[model samples]
Target: MPSSRSAPVARVSQETCNPAVCAPIAEDDKRALVDAVETFIFDCDGVIWKGDSLIEGVPETIAMLRDMGKRLIFVTNNSTKSRAGYLKKFLDLGLEITADEVFSSSFAAAAYLDSIDFPRDKKVYVVGETGILGASSSSHWPPYDRELDGVGIQHLGGESDGDKKVTLASGQLMEHDPDVAAVIVGFDRNVNYYKIQYATLCIRENPGCKFIATNMDAVTHLTDAQEWAGNGSMVGAIKGSTKREPFVVGKPAPFMLDYIANKFGIKKNQICMVGDRLDTDIMFGIDGGLRTLLVLSGVTSETELQSESNSIHPDHYTSKLADLLTVKK
Candidate 1:
């Protein structure tokens, strides 16, 4: 077993960004900043769109970046959707994004299991939506887009327990399947005590069972105008019960960062990560040794980015991703 602190990119992580240099990009230097990287990695929820609505200028800005021949990757902590589901979302918002361009935590969780050579006979217990099971309403996904299923790992207890309840009877006996080999906790709108208890049981009772979190984002933009409790809240329940932290596979973990770099055959320094949140998104880029840009259109605000107590800082701050195009030729 490896420590969660053993992230491969620890060289620059011990140091925080100097606030003096973390200032907004000057109008004259924006183009230079843009030109510094050949690849642009984006956080999907806040930086690209909010729930069902596309953020202002997102489509045009993405098109502009594409025209410049920049490699674009959309990394999302939201596990409620598979890569196929996210592609439908982009199309619904008129973004014209391909499925390959999107990388999601659900996929990361599966990727992690594959990396570890998880046994083909063992099964995973998922605490999330149908997306975690690779089962969604999108016509393109179904069995074909099933990530965990595709990897030869079967799963149980996702949306199936949405309507289930655990009545506190005088002698109610609860039981977990002995065959469950790992517990995967992701963002579930229908998360309940039943799901929490079930996941806790698997981690504590099952031998050598691994606890995995798709991500631990504190807040999520589930709707266009409000914040909802992120998957971190759900993972916290199991962690508190089992007294064990999960190996997160989402942003801030660099699992996807390393995956992206290897898949694209590019260098870490050649990539610039643009995201809104300080903890998950920005921290991910900072720890991965890639340039970071924080946008105000998401979870993080300008004050938070420049706070005295705040240690994490991005290379540049902007009101939105569209600001990258503000550079004058």
Candidate 2:
């Protein structure tokens, strides 16, 4: 794998403010930053919908952008939902989107491993749900003859898991597959002492192996509740135990941005990241050299914007996506 030590940190600022925001920006800046951007990456949950409900005006805004010949992709740090699941939700909500147009942290993680020429046929130990690692084929794991042959672990239960039988399956997987090459964690609801203990031991014994996560989001919302933990929490526990940091590949990561850039044949400067969370959405824009717009409707509240961290800052702020049409173009 490539040295992630050189990956640019995620931060946000007004580096790409529209020329209209000040004295006329140079034509090149406008062309590079605005006119050339034919693609827009939107963060799900906060930007488009909260849970299953669509934020007001999102559909119209998306439709307008689509009609204008702008390419759109929903980029999410949430790995709890698979591409098919996301596509189904979007369709259920009357939004026009396809699985191919959506990219998740899971996808980026796999791509990152692939970019560095990681062997394609190696076995991997996955500690998350199927959504994060249950693909027919993945770039993260070396290509092997077996499909899902490697040990699979689920750390926690989902919204319906409480009513189901099993919980804390990840610990069991660890017990079953101690010799796996890599360990991965995504979103789990049954995270407990056993899973953490097992994961810690695995990493401690295998320092040379890889540790990957689907995202860093700290919380997720269900129809009736908002009890969740971000992947960072897991990272923290492992780091605290092993004194080692794992490689993260998700939203705001250059790999995902690079993937989008290559997929659409668009320049990084021309892309706009529209998201509600400053850390993932806005920070991605800053680090990727793209435009950032913070929405008032998501996880990051206006009050949190007063903090000193540049990760929470955005190039532009708005209460809703509809406001973009009114941007002084």
Candidate 3:
């Protein structure tokens, strides 16, 4: 197990006793430190930027890593944006990276299903709006012409724009074809009771059918430091009603870990799980048996670390990736 530490060294508690305590890495020393890392996995959104603004020293840190010969990947749980969209965002942020270097929860979900030999030419009902649905279809998941029955009826919550209406239903799915293969859950602003009822029926009828999810992020970040309901909430609704656990394929899941490792032809033990969240990023390492690095640039904090009642801990802790510059010999 990797030891853990609080940012200022004063916040150490039973919660911080997992692995190793990492010393702070300064902005100027990021290169020499990360050069020792074969690969670097970065959490976007809070760590890189919040909304449109880039975090201070991030761009330079990325450049320094590139110069140091470390492979980098943008590991994001945000399924709202497309790969091209995120790639463009990276370029716009002056990172000079490609879409190949980035992985989204949406991508992981789609890729996971594709990796499996799911029967072709069957409809996989999607309980999501555009982003999740669109990403799932990126591999040309075809023969899917209609939405699940009652989907349109149930996807009507929160505020609605005229264009964001559900047009499918569960009854319609059963009407068209009774052999639905899977149910993919994602962010659908227009979800409703009918959609839920129908999804439950589909899962119940076909016990072998898959239930895949893009992510379980409980809160989606808003422009004003606010949080709105996310897919985790939606998944909970179905789980509560149906008593079935949907397979998560994002973040801390081994999907991305395996994907990156295979891409780089490295072992899981050789890579470090670096991110801002303890449950997701750090746990990814703990669950997968890899080292973990928890950064304070995102969701989890020192206060949260000290108060954590669980044994979950990271191998190392730092204020940010840039702080790796202070790693001592």
Candidate 4:
């Protein structure tokens, strides 16, 4: 069995520290940063709207960017919604965005599976409700069917037996399915023992079963409140049970970047990623070799940036995305 010990922490060098890794985009350089970028990739939750409310000045700023002919792409680690669903949300929030302009971890996961020619006959056991079913569906690849396709697992918060093991209502041990060739995990609001148990079983019992995840985000910001358990929490449970790491297809993985670049035919250097979180958004930009801009509107703060010890640093820091409008060319 693989040791359950946590991975060793890497020491940060002075040159690799976040501050030394990238300099803040000074007022003088703000204009250049703004002028040089031909495309802007925005993170949805924090950078644009929080919860159901749209952030102030965001609509106008986006409009201005559109007027300037800058290609705007909304990339979110959020997997709860498909691209079509995201378009509905954008429209509901009074933002003018097309379906093609939106991309989510759900879409990325589906695209990845399709790229590798995932076995159409094999079923994917979904542990969450991130629109993965719809995103991965086609005429040949149909949506999840509990009997024909695969099962949707969710935690019902039931009591464990004497040995602290999960049992079905009938007091039977959870059985693994051989047909479940892949386990797809995402943000499952109803995550429970059953979900984790089946996911673990499919991966462990089934031969060559694939473990995949939309994103590894530990927490997500909603309105002014922070949601403690994100998709990462769910993925962690399966990893702990099976000692298996999932193939993450979201930000900081560069898979989305590759998808965007190939689909839009844009150069990496010509794009800039703007978001609030240092780990997902900022590190995503850095890993993709794109200019990164950190905003204080969402999860990360100036204090956090100053104290960050890792090599994940943004090329610029702004009070908000609206501040970019004030930058003069």
Candidate with best lDDT: 1
lDDT (C-alpha) at residue 108 in model 3: 66
Kindly list the per-residue Cα lDDT of model 3 for residues 8-113, writing each as its tens digit. Answer: 2232232334433334433333333344357777778767877787877787777776776768888887766556557767778787886678777756666666
The most accurate candidate by TM-score is 1
Positional deviation of residue 65's Cα in model 4 after best superposition, in angstroms: 0.9
TM-score of each: 0.90, 0.74, 0.77, 0.81
lDDT by candidate, in order shown: 0.82, 0.62, 0.63, 0.73
User: What ranges in model 1 sit over 4 Å off?
Assistant: 1-17, 141-144, 168-171
TM-score result, candidate 3: 0.77
Q: Native-vs-model 3 lDDT? A: 0.63
Candidate 1, 192-216: lDDT as tens digits? 9999899888899998999999998
lDDT of 2 at 301: 63
Q: Which is superior by TM-score, 2 or 4?
A: 4
Model 3 Cα displacement at 104 (Å)?
1.0
Error of 3 at 39 (Å): 0.7
